[model samples]
Target: MPDIIRLLPDNVSNQIAAGEVVQRPSSVVKELLENAIDANAKQIQLMVKEAGRNLIQVVDNGMGMSATDARMSFERHATSKIANTEDIFHIKTKGFRGEALASIAAVSQVELRTKKEEEEVGTQIIIEGGQLISQEVIHIPTGSSFQIKNLFYNVPARRKFLKSNSVEFRHVLDEFHRVALAHEDIQFQLYNNGEELLRLRSGNLLQRISDIFGRKIKNLLIPISEELEWVKLSGFVGKPESAKKTRGEQFLFVNHRFFKSTYFNKAVQDAFEGLIPQRYLPSFFLYIEIDIERIDVNIHPSKTEIKFEDESSIYALLRTAIKKSLGVYHVAPSLDFEQNQDWVFSIPKKDSPIEEPKIKINPAYNPFKENSKPFTKAEKLNVTEFYSSFRNDDITSDLFDAPSANNEENFLRLMNGRWMIEHKGQLWCIDPYRIHQTILYNKYIKSIKNHALSQQLLFPLERPVYDLEKEKLISIQSKLFAQGFDMQIEDDLLTITAIPSDILQEKVLDIIEELLYQLTEHSEEEFSVFFSKSVSKVSAKKRNEFIQSSQIRPIWEEFKNLEMPYLNPLNKKNYEIISIPNFE
Candidate 1:
């Protein structure tokens, strides 16, 4: 037997810490930007090359470090944020854990240049893989510039596992946006591969939001604010009409730190229960200011998830604030039992001749004239012949089970926007929207893989956008084209002349907006799913627009081909079946 356990070397220890702190290139961006914010920088500049794989540089006009402090900054567990254990509870700065710099340096090539405001000269310290290459006094400005290059160079496995440049760039862009939005008073500029991608001027939170989103969204915002003995909540909630089918526009912060909490998000969603359409999430930029001792920001490595001492009270007050804002802005209906009834019942009298309600109908219309080949139920449902008329080979062969020789196949559109299908001897209720989404999702994944063709529009549509949005849209133009959207950036506008053939032309503009928002706010994998769902709703027939059973035929026809016809794209049951109870 031998004693095998030994203390890991400092380099090995830091490399292990890097695994937690520096998950990807964007993680580096988050650390550097937050460090700049903590430095009291009025203007922060970030530049990245090849989506941060080649280089990531952050320069800030903040109070810089001295020659001795510059060298100590790279040492693991050396930090200025905390002195005693009590300081941990009252954490105010972004970079509290001193492991960030050391961890980042262990896996990458880092060069730090810093000079204090009163110092006549600066210090340039270059370190590679936790080993100091050089440290010398140099003439520099009164700030700090951290240049991290060849990220994960010492860790070849992690470098190889990085996503494509486009995808990685998106992650970096998201970090930049989050930091910029969290601190609206500090100007931030982002550059990618030498081109200025984003410039956020210092302003109020609402101004920053409007600038980033590239729209006059002020009209869509309703201010909300409330203060209790323990917590204060204030921010802007988008009007119900401004709610979207996607979930990108929501931003929540605690003491100017961006974090994600579905628990708190549900409070906002519950406030708009009946105001917005089902399955649609409202947009909100909420800020919570509470005692630092009552909340723990160290629950996660990235500090994006926090624990509140009394979340229930916070939730109750937050939901109330949002509901009050909505009602005050008249975005939600208000009931006043004290109002007089005479004005409500009286309509302005018209002097013109009274006109009878006209019945609009098509006299020559017939419901049985479907373009697909039809066979009665007696033929045992010739699925081979039926799918052939669809001209799609992707459809699976899971149409239905063997039908009884009792009833004919029938589709009846129910008043509540569901479908009633009488097949064989059973009746099934179907959610057409979910079925539609499943079909569209399948089709879209295939299209993306196959590089489907686009359908050109008769009229080119131009949407006004800010310069920042144009740059972002142009960057992801190739990805959009792969999904069959031909988008171009003209002066101050995003122009589209074509879209996916399966998409509805009437909603081309809205679909484009959702696509851009989702791509900007989510990862590539999530954007695909969200894009499909958003388009499915806008393209599918509205619940109130059903004229006959024929409109539902397309959804039914596509749903029958699903590998699991019982479930929708989200894996939820789209239909319910009930057997008849015999009365003997």
Candidate 2:
């Protein structure tokens, strides 16, 4: 009763540690890749099956360990990187806590094969459920290969919590990207279910980034490099136009280790304050190098969070560096006071004299006469009729005129591109664009729901998009087809053969592009919300085109027919009213 709390068993403690270190397949991928890097691997290959739930294998050409050292590597807190407590702060390698392998082995079936460069033979070891199965001497290559299978097999609860393969694969890809980005010189390859996903060769930072994201990113990157007393920053920031609505491409690395820091992220984002649209995050790959003593990497088990000695200074420096790079690359505006040679004008010779001015005038023009002659009979009749038409007309006459029984003409007046209507001594100013958007939004929603008519195009349109975008489009192809879009995908180009009748032929491409952008922005939103937003955006774009009064009458009629004409689809006020006092 006195000693209720006692030491937990090694297996139990190891499994508990696995909860933090090996959260998912991605966590396993990260730990294994870091271990490979720490081993001074020049080339590494990662093979995964079923998003690492079934199998995860890593083969690296690095310095392998001896048999005794290999056996001891899986012991809890057994590490060669750190000697004592003093080594925690001054850390250089990726793995120092030494809990990664122990924890991973506790929940997965592990197999290890290693051979030192100086050894003539290698050792093959297999373990399951945190217990070593067998160790045998075998002849193998001078490196290490680790195979982890049945991840979380011993922990059924953890296995059950894993997400779908697509989601889990995305996380795995994220981890692979972080590790591959931090070490550009190491050759890395990734394969899923026997299909190659990424094959990165040894290159510089920029080349590595371009290889991973796509070669098109090369032109969009702005180089940033700054060396200071406290910190050194280097890498690239994307141009403002290349900014994305999602926060997927942003990365920050410290001392060759990938980490996340909201403080540092905000600093970089501040540099693009006015350059990018609101809520859009810019793609950046920034690397920060500082003294090990100035940072505590052990603050988090994942080692993604670090406490800096002078965060404020680092933030200021990072922001300034990124801003300077943007200015240098002409991605951001800069003032240049230096004169341009092409803009200079040559001075006239001293011998040349200025020319005298000459003037011409019509001296016979009359001050007050109609063409210097009396008015004709027809002109007199026109003038008399024009004056008679205004006899009973006043500023308030038309304002008070009600619509006729025919309803062909509208009483709404167009002033400065806005519609104004007067009723009961009060004037209402309406935004025609907003009202039209609401009307079209409702119309399109109904059309989509009812499978409205689609106008087949005489000439199909083809648009080129990236691989990721093509995948996204394919995922929602059925929904698009249901919405009156007859589209076909051929490689990276999307060909449109038909579109909704209401959407103009010329605006089809623009509407599709807007839809894709919205898809990227609201990927996590429900399908209903996504569909509504896509239709609304397309309708908004069409409403911006110039419309004649005749065309506006029909749109205004539709708007009036809406149940909520005072508000747009987004619930924003579409018009405002003001009382104008009549003074006699």
Candidate 3:
């Protein structure tokens, strides 16, 4: 008999933890930036090379660690943030789970240089794969400088899984944005491959937002704040028109810690229900402040998703805050900014109308000709010969059967926006324009779409998304596939050659984008009925209007039955015309 279980090696244990903590380069960025913020640094500088694949360095002017503390900082579970198990529930600082440094060091080559403000000398600690390689007392800056290089170098399998440098770099940028947004009082600077990307100076929250996104967005944002009994909510929400088609601009922070909460997100969305177009989501950067004891951030490996004692209250507060802000801003009501701030002057004179050009029309081409009236049943039957002349039996059969399948086909559009085929007996209808609006709204609300790749583009086009949006993109791969996007990762770039559904591929990209933006906010199910109804109406209208045999002679001549009378008994009520109902 032999023992069945055994302890895993230090390297293996560290690697397993690293898998959870450092899923990508962005994970590393989150850890390092959090550590800097926890250190109470007023200024933090982030620099990345090759989208963080080559190098990721964070230099912060926070309170530096002592010589002894610097060496111990690399040890797993060794943290100054938490004293015991009770401290886990009341975590206030960002880097409480000492595992970040240890996990980070396990998967990459890490070098730490830190010194106290009063001390003349600083300590440098270097580690790789959970093993300390070097520890030296060196003269450097007053805060902390962490450099992580050759990530997953020892684990080729993990390294191979790494997306392109650009993708990885986007992740880093995301982490950088989260911390920067949370702590507006701290100055943050970021450089990528020797190019200055961000220079965020310490100031008000609005200024910090402008620094990160750009000055153009500042004017597009509305201030949102609400102080509830236990929770304090404050942030700026983008005006409905300002939200982008993608999921790049949403930010949520809990007690200065960046985290994701679907409950909270729903609250914000509920608030903007009627104001924002269904196809577009509101852009917001909101921070929630609550008691440390009422929340828990220690559950997840990376500490991104959180659990609250009273999430419903928090959610409601968020929704109300955003809604109130929208009301105050009068976003829907067009504001006369010109009149609001007065200093008007000149009055302009009105001009007369311009002359119209005369257009001569041929009597044959005139739609309003004396004998041109709506087609009657006899006329429709006569025109059947003309319609039949254009195509072969297969095309004719399909066109004839199309009316029967209209309900099912339209229902499919309502259910999933694009298409889905089901039995016609199960569907209903609504206003088509409203269906379009609803579908667009639903898609926009769930900005991340999973579309399948149809075909690659002939030429590879390169574009950029904020580094923070990488995770969101990765999360939305399946939806993108459903939407018909064939995408691949090459560094920070997302190469798209194909779309998910064949229908979207046929349409122009701009139209597709419009559909996406519009349908994202509404309920696909609700819009389905409307969509079906509209499609059915239009299709029915087209079916009733029959043309003469002479007009369609070239196409319909082959299938024409000139001798047969084309009488439709149920043209308006039903598509098919039955000769006689058999009553038994």
lDDT of each: 0.82, 0.82, 0.67
Give lDDT: candidate 2, residue 478.
86
Give per-model TM-scores. Answer: 0.75, 0.73, 0.63
lDDT of 1 by residue, 1-584 (tens): 99999999999999999999999999999999999999999999999999999899999999999998999999998999999999989999998988889999999999999999999999999999999999999999999999999999989999999987876876787788789889999999889899986788998988888777765678788998888898899999988877875555788999999999999999999999988877788989999999999999888789999999999998898888888777766676544423434447746478866768899999988898887776777565676667567745344332332344654367776678887887556788988877776777788777666767789989988876644445457766876777788877854567788888877787887776665555542454555666666676556555666545667766676677785378765577888997778899
The TM-score of candidate 3 is: 0.63
Kindly report which residue stretches of model 3 are placed more than 4 angstroms away from their true locations once superposed. 332-584
Best model number under TM-score: 1
Clashes by residue pair, model 2: none
Question: Candidate 2, residues 31-146: lDDT per residue as tens digits?
Answer: 98999999999999999999899999999999998999899999999998999999997999999998999999999999999999999999999999899999999999988999
Error of 3 at 3 (Å): 1.5
How much lDDT does candidate 3 score? Answer: 0.67
Ranking by TM-score: 1, 2, 3
Q: For model 2, where is the 10-residue window of minimal lDDT?
A: 333-342
